[model samples]
Target: MRIKVLALSLIGCCSAMAWAQQKEPTKPAETEVYEPVPPKVRVNEKGIPSDAIVLFDGSNLDAWMSGRDGDAAQWTLNADGSMTVKDKAGDIRTRQEFGSVQLHIEWKSPAEVQRKGQNRGNSGIFLQDRYEVQVLDNNNNDTYVNGQVGSIYKQAIPLAMASKPSGEWNTYDIIYHAPVFGKLGEVIQKGSLTVIHNGVLIQDHFELLGTTEYIGWPKNKPHGKGAIRLQDHRDNSRVSYRNIWVRELE
Candidate 1:
């Protein structure tokens, strides 16, 4: 019995010693990844990337058409390098269709605050011509949170209100992922959007449920690539836009 106890104690001591001598986990090795810089045209001195498609460079409206019936875009193109909304001209959309894309656009509300609430310099940028990223004069202006500037229309509220004062330009840098549909027109993977408004992160990789609607619940309608639509509002808001560009993604 004495020998057995001594043997057990020794075994326990050896095990404890082994455990104490064990080393901690080694850290993973660091490796560098190679990412080549792409070429860019840098038009309008906007620093637009080389792989981007210039939609409007403050020159003309050749890349756009009327969203109502595919007619030519009739918005007033100013010599000041911006396009002003000609009320009653109907919504304008890009003639070229795109799927997933990284889009950059700059807009400014009229210097004069015309109307209040939903009618205050209201406009929108519709991805796939369906999902809306609302544009409004929310600076010192109050409205529904989900329908305010930088919101996804009435669907998703912005994380922050990032709108400049009236007449000041605000930039929207959006990265959109198109939804994938199955064979039977069912959504296999939902789309997502990441929006940076005026250099502020508002929508942080928001998952789009479906098409943005103002009257009813959002619905998923299977559709292919579509043009980027700009709402006219038709209320004489006089919103101006310039320096629009997009980069298609795979």
Candidate 2:
């Protein structure tokens, strides 16, 4: 019986030693993936990626329509390749609808400053026409941090203030992921936003709660792909936008 136990222990030890002697790949190519080749994208001199959809190139409003009634966009297109808000003309939105995307847009507040707080240079870039990335001239201005420039509206506060001067062009590069909903209008996965303001990281992949609301809590209403809407604000803010483009994500 003792010799039998000793033989069994020896067998186990030998098996363990044999397994330990097997080695993993030491070369990089052994684990490299090469079948799925990524497509090439060319960036123009204006820094527009070839695969990106040009929403606004300062040439025309063909890609946009009235946000209120879906008519011709009424924003003022300038010679310098920028569009200024038409105040009472209502908001403008892209004619094309999208889901998750990478959006790039440049905006500038009026050179001549105006009212304080939410009234100054107030506008917004709405993803899915629901989630808003607050657009305001926060340079030398004070407002609620969660509603300031680079914020995910009243939901997520920005990590930092990266506003250029009021009149200077400030760029917003946003990577947005739309929410996934269950069959019965329940949230399966919350949406998220990553925002870069004027080349500075402000919002770091912040998960959104729901739709951005000013007077009440956000509502999670299940919906499909939606248009990108630029807020009018209707305050005579005269916020200008240019060089708008987006790259859709799979």
Candidate 3:
């Protein structure tokens, strides 16, 4: 099945090239740069590619509605187009729901050192607002290996700590699969996650034990398509995010 999918993707790419070539020879030429984009890096290309939705590009968060009241994102947008957490405004989730999504999120911790460890810089990008892939400054600081940087919250520990220092931006490139529940509320297909933290493979083919937590074990409850959420830990962490985008997979 995987090989078939790969073949289909290659065929699609070739067909796209052919279509471009047949349309208007006077148009500008297309080039393959052979560049590998690291995690959380933004792609500035235009138009939809298959099943996807662009959330942010340092332009506006109008694509986001308040997870609290279905209003526009109230976070502070900087001159550079990044969005900062609004202290106590809680989290902001996408108004449009998603099932299986490829999420791209880039975040930066505080540069000035006031606290240490988790208190220093902590935040998360929540898929479906339930399962959380952690975000913290795990560069060299010591903390719980599982819950520190790139673990699936508290359930599964990361393969390695791939984090930059506080203040430097880090990225999380995640491909998330939502759980499939039956009529009796039994999960037939437990969700799975693949995360690349800061250009490093941390959680490769990790099965989610349950929803991420700070005080308890994971619990797998039945769910469906849900909104993507950015956490608000209610500290002075001053976490910033940009280049937020997603591609829904069927």
Candidate 4:
């Protein structure tokens, strides 16, 4: 029994020595993996990398041509670097084409508060000249739910109502994926959009139903490349737009 106990103590000492020799997990070689500098992002609050093209940066509107006859834009340039709708000068659009885009636009209704509903600072940012993600002054005012601020205009209502009072600047950072179709004009991959209205997410990867309209249901028009149009509703709402930029996607 004495010999057995002596052997057991020896074994325990050997095991403890072996364990002590083992270096405790020295904080795994903290090799700093410095990532490469990301690309220029137009509107990526999520820190995603992107390439962008600046349209209007309080500099010039040369990137945009008239929606009427391809001449210079007719909108009046505000002293604050914003461009106001010519009221009856029709709409303006970029001269380029885009498939998927990260769009950032800043706008505001005239301080001189206007009429109510549909006519209250009514305007639109028409993507691909077809899909209209609406822009309206819905502060304490009501209108058609699906056609109000941050709407996919007549298709899907916003996930929330986030509109600043009139005159204050409101912003929209939109990620838009253009539609994809099969041979039979049937939608294969429907377009999706996520909109941030005034730093609030109002549209979250919402599927588009088709082009926006006033008096009818959504329709799937054939796809190709199209311009970005700003609607001039002919209501003299004095819509202003600034900080316009875009980043194309493959």
Give the candidate number with the greatest lDDT: 2
The lDDT for every candidate, in the order shown, is 0.88, 0.92, 0.78, 0.84
Q: Rank the candidates by lDDT, best first.
A: 2, 1, 4, 3
Candidate 1 vs candidate 3: the TM-score winner is 1
Residues 112-184 of candidate 2 have per-residue lDDT tens digits of 9999999999999999999999999888889899999999989999998988887899999999999999999
Provide TM-scores for the models. Answer: 0.84, 0.89, 0.78, 0.80
Q: Is candidate 1 or candidate 4 better by TM-score?
A: 1
Worst 10 residues of 4 by lDDT: 28-37
Q: Which candidate is the best by TM-score?
A: 2
The better-scoring model by TM-score among 2 and 3 is 2
**Residue runs of model 3 more than 4 Å from their true location after superposition:** 1-51
Candidate 2 CA-lDDT value:
0.92
- The better-scoring model by TM-score among 3 and 4 is 4
Residues 133-226 of candidate 3 have per-residue lDDT tens digits of 8877665567877778887887788887777777877888899988888999988888899999878988887877778878877777788788
Global fold similarity of model 1 (TM-score)? 0.84
lDDT at 52 for candidate 2? 99
Residue 218 alpha-carbon offset, candidate 4, angstroms: 1.0
Candidate 3 at 94: error in angstroms? 0.8
TM-score of 2: 0.89
A best-first ranking of the candidates according to their TM-score comes to 2, 1, 4, 3
